[model samples]
Target: MHQGGKFIVVEGGDGSGKSTQARRLADRLRDAGHETVLTREPGGTASGAALRQVLLEGSLDARAEALLMAADRAQHVTEVIGPALARGAWVVSDRFVPSSLVDQGVGRALGVDAVEALSDFATAGISPDLVLVLDISDDVSKVRRASEDPDRFERESEEFHARVREAYRSLAAQRGWVVVDGNLEVDVVADKIWSVACERLEP
Candidate 1:
């Protein structure tokens, strides 16, 4: 059974409910007597926090963006994820390698193979055991983020977002990750996520 030291990554485009679902699933795992560390990419470590602000708020070249994201991931895995997993704790991250693969790789017109290679190098081959992709439409993403102040990536052109969303779908399918419809009701979505986790991670 997939128990100790397991790393589960929840991935999606903006407004796809990945963060909420990741937190809920991690909590459920903890409640079920698992030592779970709920975390997120680009902000998990202290160095990563500063990198997250620059990555999210400031504009940079596509290559720079990819490199910065990789830097954050490096620090995050080294400081937080690696230690937590080494001590027999399960780590559930809100986003991980897939986000870069879609955002910088597809959305920013960078090649997926290159971004993936960079990410793999950054993480030193440490990869997720499970990746749950919460999928939603572009319209839904816009509506859900309407009231919030848009970040650099969030303020990209609609076409960019379209590509990102499509890339997420394609990549998730290619990687055999679970694709959950994020248009469902919150409770329902949570139930579906939890059910899948139970099936896959439980003995």
Candidate 2:
């Protein structure tokens, strides 16, 4: 078992398979005898869920949307993630600060530095110990997204998603985040993520 709980975040553009991989990783960790808590951004806490509806369903301005995301994150970290970590439970989040950076900062043109600073303040310096970025081509993301009911971000133009993906790639490169090939089959992607996560988990 780890001395302290670890925070793991899965990030990707729409339809890049973040949810699936996050669940699989959490399950794998639990089966290995680690206590794990699986959660998601913008919907983890009661207040955050309400904010998520507004952010995803309402026609808010880009700045408003970004602020709302930060608000949700603050609640999530305080109410759910922070407590879990304090008690020694590994927290696996489907999306975290990186999503705000790419979706609002880059895709909406608010600037990455500004979003990063806001997110840092909102979470009070809490950050993921590992960030797994599911990297997929734009074409693949489009095809995968076609089957789902589009959320506010999913309804964005192809150019917007391209920018989001590029920003994720750039951030991952600069931050040394693990980038997984999301175009592969589900089990293949899960195996890859699990392998990488195992390396990061403390014994």
Candidate 3:
């Protein structure tokens, strides 16, 4: 089952329904008989999960939080993503570098170049062949999940989310990512994502 291929990443801001879409995509891939691995960043592997709590709730300094994210990403890529890809499994991550680009790069006011550099190193040179960036307005996102506890990052004001959205838009434009509208229903969004992914999966 070791057919080589590039990794795929799905990234978006809070309440964009990334988790729902990712699960749907993974399920579709499985039904289509493709080996697929569904996972999330900041909490994929054991090490990353532990770090996720600290990064989301703890009062670490901005620099420290950024560094911890990078560390967690490194471990995730090495332990989960790399091996899965090596085994011909299609890795669909709910988040990846875009979280850092938004949460740390723009939200925390860290420069884009610095975040990109750290992300490049942490991923050990594995760049996602296709990055699906879901775009949604801050207002829409805020209302999507009213019951979920607001984490430290999620507790930020609308101004912060606006900046993060801008950052994601900029990255999508710069990287030619597959930009999908997150305002749609989960199945519709997954359908669009699947189309893009299937196109890329072709020889």
Q: Candidate 2, residues 147-194: lDDT per residue as tens digits?
A: 999998899999999999999999999998999999999999999998
Which scores higher on TM-score, 1 or 2?
A: 2
* Of candidates 3 and 2, the better by lDDT: 2
Weakest 10 consecutive residues of candidate 2 by summed lDDT: 194-203
Task: Show pairs that collide, candidate 2.
Answer: none
**All candidates' TM-scores?**
0.96, 0.97, 0.94
Candidate 3's residue-wise lDDT over 95-182, tens digit each? 9998898889889988878988999999987767778989998779888645588888777788888898888998889888888999
Q: Which residue segments of model 3 deviate by more than 4 Å?
A: 1-3
Q: How close to the true structure is residue 187 of candidate 2, measured as C-alpha lDDT? A: 99
Clashing pairs in 1: none
lDDT of 3 at 155: 78
RMSD of 2: 1.5
Q: Rank the candidates by TM-score, best first.
A: 2, 1, 3
lDDT of 1 by residue, 74-149 (tens): 9888988888888888999999999999999988889999999999989986888888999888889889877678
TM-score of 1: 0.96
lDDT of each: 0.88, 0.91, 0.85
How would the candidate models be sorted by lDDT, starting from the highest? 2, 1, 3
